[model samples]
Target: MKYLKPWRSDGGGLLHLTILLSLAGLRLDLDLDLCLLLPPPTLLRDELLLGCDPTSPAYALSPYPAPGGWGRADQLHPKGREADPAAPPEGQLLREVRALGVPFIPRTRVDAWLVHRVAAGDADGAHGLLGAAAASSAGGVGAGVDGGSQAAPGGGGDPRASPSSPLAARQEEKAPAEQTARVPDADGRASEENEVLRERHEAVDHSSQHEENEQRVSAQEEKSLQQKNEDENKTADKPDWEAEKTTESRNERHLNGTDTSFSMEDLFQLLSSSQPENSVEGISLGDIPALPGSSNDGMNSSAHYNVNFSQAISHDVNLHEAMLLCPDNTFRRDPVVRTSQPQEPFLQLNSHTTNAEQSLPVANLTAFLPFVDNQMRNLTSEDFLHDLNINIFDEINLMSLATGDLDAMEVSQLFQEPDSDSGLSLNSSHNSTSITKSNTSHSICEEGATGYSSDPESLPHHNLEGAVGGNYPAPMGHRSDSGFCGDLAFQHVFHNHTYHLEPRALESNSESFSWPEKPEKMSRYLSDTERNLSRDERRAKALRIPFSVDEIVRMPVDSFNSMLSRHYLTDLQVSLIRDIRRRGKNKVAAQNCRRRKMDIILNLEEDVCNLQAKKETLKRERAQCNKAINIMKQKLHHLYHDVFSRLRDDEGRPVNPNQYALQYSHDGSVLIVPKELVTSGHKKENRKRKREGIEDGFH
Candidate 1:
């Protein structure tokens, strides 16, 4: 398995999971399907039966021998000295199929997939499918036992079967003599026993060649079979009698001779020869055990299995052609012939096919999509509240941050346990008038490593928090990002205004205070509305203005005048009220002005970006058009020269391209004009340019 480290600052590793099983000592291979690469199936199709027994060439290319078995990825031995001298070069092959450098099985995915197939097991189908194919040969070997057995136990493609060194032959000749001596045959019958063994060995050697002929095949036969299938597909309605006769003659010769390109149909013929019995062979998935839902009843059973080509071709027009995907991802007219060890089924890629997706031209889907306009997006005070999405309830115990309406609270509690009865709270509201009149500014820098940070605010609490003492606990929850809106607070900053509700102002509500006009409920109203009052609210209250801030700010000019006439306020009170109303209106107007200014700037930026992208696209298109125009002009020049050279004017002389020009008439005819006319047109354009220049100078 391959691993790539995380490319993020937060350290972590991406993991791939794979299971390596030793179930029943079978090495399983999974067949990959083209459709599985797309979305629909969600997994590989189970019908593409897996190949078995690793190919000799497949292992010869591996970097190192796999430690466990054939399916595992090779790993280097921890120690240098641990090496197997007898291991063949074929033990270390690393083979994989790929398309345009993309491995069919991603290197990062689990090595093999088979977990979803079998029940009451580790559920890898690699071996189950392998066993099913072997079941065919096993049945053949069982029935053919009477005919005579010749296959060696180590299986086909074993290096030991090949003829090699004379020294190995000498050892083989002397091995029985040594064995007989070790066995202590006191009856002295070793010579007679050796002769009997020699005769039996000779018969066994001769028998294997004939047996191997039944399965072994040459590539030419596979090629002919594919061609025959293609020819049949092309001539479905009108059969090619000559080609059919040729294929039949070739097949008869192949069966009569030694060479064979193993076909499933042939294998079943040699196994269960009856036509009706072989009909069920492929439908049974190479004799693999039936799944619970699959019907085991012979005829009905095939309804659950895919049609097996090995047992049931039935002269279908293009059935063989449907077996393999072509380069264009469509099925070809003939299946690719694959080869394997006579004892073990294996797989190979068809040398013929090419991938369709790689070859086809594709268009960009999003090229024509329209751009979005985000210029008018707004940041409201409600927007600021929702930015945090904070639910500030009495029970929640959230810190009031100092960045805005909420405290980016540098400190939640200002004092530690000085006394059980004493405590301190951090609040930044400007409502208190006399506790500490030191006006402080809070930082709104809003830029840093976390995309947010603040410079210190000039607060009286900083001095007091030192006089008192406390440390902080770890912060809770995700940090909320709120970009400071400095525009709304500009009026207060510019005017150096502080809106404070003084305790002495509310003292008028106490019974001891004199209210010569009437004993009115003043403090009750103030208490209920105090928390939500605006800066204008505080100013109106300080001046003892008789209306709410909203009424003062929103009242029309005529209505405001009527309100003033109704109230018998002093000159100082009236002036203060007018100043308050003017400042409030101007403040709102300024904020709108600023918001609109920023919006216009943002819209201009977006416009510039879109126009720049369009400019680049147009530049490329213009270059392409210019190239096309030049090519067309060159062609037209050649055509014009050829036409002029072939033309004769009145005296049977050829016309010259440089001296004459052709112009089309309105009535579908061509006329020749002298080259001097082109020169006159050019002179006229020069005069027009000069005239335009003189006109611009006068302007």
Candidate 2:
């Protein structure tokens, strides 16, 4: 609300309150909008609360003792002292307890944070001072620090113990420049170690909200939280009299001596207290849900990493299903073969049917299946002109032959040529001959891969692999783009797989991964998330491959070959990945070829029906033309007689209608020629040929 007050006027008279998060003494303020993306119940919180041992690190912040004990050996303590109902108040403390005996959070705040730092394993004088404060019988902090009977539990005399509140700030002003060194790494800068383990179990979340906190506090907060700790440590190293004066000052401020009451004995007493009984409702008194950016999730500097494992790839020995990927990536529990072996056939000794050995084992037969299937599919002819789009039902095609999709265009073209010449007075016989020849030629030529490529090398570089692997290959035909994509699905059922892999990681059976200090690095340690990444990607990461998998899958063959030439790959790597390009292209080519063949067959069938219809139409048109020609001949005969009757030639007689006929020459000249003249020439030629044949025989 305070930050929003100034922005209210600027934001269209509206105000927005931001939520704040603190982690490892880092303040982060986040906008309300980001809450949508970040979910709750993260693993980091669970690990920080439940995983760390308090004495191990400087930040194992289990500050307050457990309900019954500081540690229960996780309820496995041997003496069973906490469970003894008659033991003492301490033993009964864990049973039916509603409140803690002490005020854990104080109203008159001191530098109790210093005590927590000491508990966290800081080796400075803070621990001894705190111990002295704890031995005070007054059940208060200042009562003992003011030269009371309390002494350090470790035999070190009490060091200076000052108030943690604003009282310590006064001493901080008088400190020399040398003792006031600022804390290193207080700039919220992430280090190299932070980059490796981006997601960890105990990382202190420095989410976007945290970044906002830095911005908000940049002006008001001069000393960082770490620097404050360092300054308090310096103030604690003061002389005993200074400590006494500090205690007096706190008394003047009216803060009671309550902070001094806790000690090592208190911790042991708390641990030995009775524990609460379990509830069927599964309720725990200790559950405090932390928000996404809270310190409880990832406050540790050294966050522990949990490893991720991959499912084992399985191989099936069944011949029928061998080519298919397994439903489970791991092996199934089934036996090797499905049915019992057939009994061997018996053979007779003489002139009888002999039995061959029992059929070869299934495993041996499995090897040949792929080869046989490939050969059968390869029998399909290439479809080179498959992609061109044409109207399969053109009117011209229907008028032509009964050709299907492929031959429709050729038939239509032939029909068009004949129609253009039909207007000429050419005889009907000449037109029929040309149409028959065109149809015959369209079907016979240009059949297979041989027509497209002379050798197998031209057919998508099939024969070239061995040749290219061994030596430089000859230049080949243009490459066809035969790439195809299939649905890529990978499933990992969580049951029986999650817990199964955890023990190996705990046992450190796999290779160790370095932990980066960044909070995001926590995801790297989560097996569930890691399992979702690409299997091949994980494989490449594991292999430390220099190039990306996408590049290997997407680049052209020539470019891929060039890349291979650039790097020296192992034989296993070369063989394993060699078929990636071939398989992808072949899948696409098969789809294209299948489509083309179907189109050709369909068009041919259509064209065949179309040509039959045209045949009927042509027959009708030929009958009409023949009838018209006969009518014209009859008209000519009547006109000839009429003209002869009206003739007034030099003899005034009608021309001999039967002897003479009208003829037309190529030069467009009209001539009257005797019909007998034409007949006499044909007859004389035939007689001359017969006479010549007889003369040649006589010779």
Candidate 3:
């Protein structure tokens, strides 16, 4: 009777399936050694056991306590079983234990795990191993329970009697034998009651069996899922591995490029064979096929196959041999002469010849003089030697002048016209050709001279000077061992000429020439400003800044703006504001002003809050005082009523005010505020406020 409701009613069929699904999804991958217990087994077990009343002593000894009756009164202890406020039902406890044990029930666990892996497509043996471990453990515990159950049915039956005592006989005599009797003549009422009890027990047992079945089915489903996972993993790995291998093979093919049967070693031999045996250093020739439309007759083919040995020997060939493998003339064949003169037959300065051109340095004129000689020697062979001699002397003067040789003037004067026929040949049919030749020759002569822009009249009059100054004339009043070259050359020319004149040649022969003093100065046609600038440059001093108020006033506004902007004072508005404000109030005072503004806004909000709080506090105080006053009034009224009732002659009536004075405590202190003072304070505060307002208007 103490069992109240059957245990099976507390559990449900869906419980097992829900637990199994949760177990499968849970992140806690329980190790075999940790066992099938919840994280905090004590807490969980106790919490889950709620309402089971395990703490009750009688219930603890026997879950279904002996039927409460008068006969068992002597056996019952004075302190009955204390019911536990928290205790789970028998079915829930059994299910929880099984949920924990499911992973350890060896045989079933191994089977489930293997099947799960297969269903889940996980080929790895990990799942099966873990499942087997759990299954074996649970199976052992379950087997132990089964063995004990077989050893003793109903636990020796009848929980009411002490099993070992001979007093049991007496207890049996008192036991309700009619409860077990199967008589057919029993009343329908009794029989129906029995049937009802039997049905309830059978229904509970059936529900428990259903729960067990659900757990078994859930385990089977999990096994299938695990197995499916294994299979899928195995299948996925196969294509990935094969794809990796295929990619590697394709990469190998791309790098080798071995479509043809020819090997790299054979190709190397053929390439080497195409080049000549005597090929120079740094030369490499590739195997070149024959050109299209080329004559490949025996003689021509022989020429194509052969190397130009003489041409190769004449120069150090730095070019690759692959270049020579092409058709004839595809590669250049000119000799690169690094140390010799040009082949134009011009006399060289380094040569040991007394000839004028041979004695002169060729460095300056060599670049320009080659073409004239080439053309002159090639045309009109009859005067070639004589013309060559005359041209050689002319080239010497040009070369000497080009190189700034000390003997340039002498050479130039020597080669100067013995007659008017001294200049370039004018009778040539090719004016353009002659002009080109003349320009080149003259250019060389001009570059070689001391001054490229020298005046012809000033040449003979020029005196010795340091060559560092670019001016061509030598300074006067100085004597050298050989005299200045220009002066010497001038004297030689003068003495050799047919015309003789006095020492002061210009004065005696005014018809021939005249000269002016201050010859070194530049032409007088120079402007005054230009002359003044040159004279000022000749002196060394810093120039003073030319300042004028008008110039400053005329300065562009853009220039002034640019200067202002660089200094970050560009905005006119900013400047105007700065000018007006000049110095702001002290920092502290400014800060205080800003603070006051913020405080006013914030204080406005705070004032409303404080006022509300004050109102609430006042309301609360008023309510408390009112409640106290009402309570006191009620007490006073009762006191007055009691006093009046005691003092009256039999009729109920009001009491004397002196006899029933109001009494109360406020804030833990006695207060005695008379009604008159309270009323007067209120009236005075109102009158004072009204008078102050009237006085402010009068002021």
Compared with the true structure, what per-residue lDDT tens digits does model 1 show for residues 1-699? 001001100000101000000000000101111101111122122111222123221111111122321111111111111121211121111122121121122111011111111111323232232222211111111111111112212111112112332322433455456544443222222221222122212222222222222112112223334444454444333334544444344333432343354443344343344223222233223222222112342212223234443212211111111122111222232232222111111111211112222111111101100100010011012221121111111001111111011111222121111111111112223213211332122112211110110101112122111111111100111111110111111111110100010122112211111111111322332334443455445434433456776777799999999988766553333544676788889999999999999999999999999999999999999999999999999999898888898888899888887898887767999878888986797699799999999999999
For 58-86, candidate 3 gives per-residue lDDT tens digits of 12211111223111211211122111112
**Alpha carbon RMSD to native, model 2:** 34.9
What TM-score goes with each of the models?
Answer: 0.21, 0.21, 0.13
Model 2 clashing-pair count: 44
C-alpha root-mean-square deviation, candidate 1: 45.7
**Cα-lDDT of candidate 1:** 0.26
Worst 10 residues of 3 by lDDT: 26-35
What value does the lDDT take at residue 699 in candidate 2? 100
Model 3 clash tally? Answer: 53
lDDT, candidate 2, 1-699, per-residue tens: 000110110110010111111111122111111111011222122112211232221111111111221111111111111111111122122221213222121100111222122224432332222221111111111111212112112211122222231212322343234123422132111110111011111112223223343333321121221123242344346654454344234322321222333221222233223222211011110110112322322122101001000000000011112211112211111111111100000000000001112111222222323332232123212110010000100111111111111122222222222111111111123234322323222211111111111111111111111111111111111111110000000000000011112222222211111111222542434255444544333333222233555666678879988977665442212332343344445656888899999999999999999999999999999999999999999998888777656654468667776777666677999566788876786599799999999999999
lDDT of 1 at 638: 94
- Candidate models: Cα lDDT each: 0.26, 0.24, 0.25
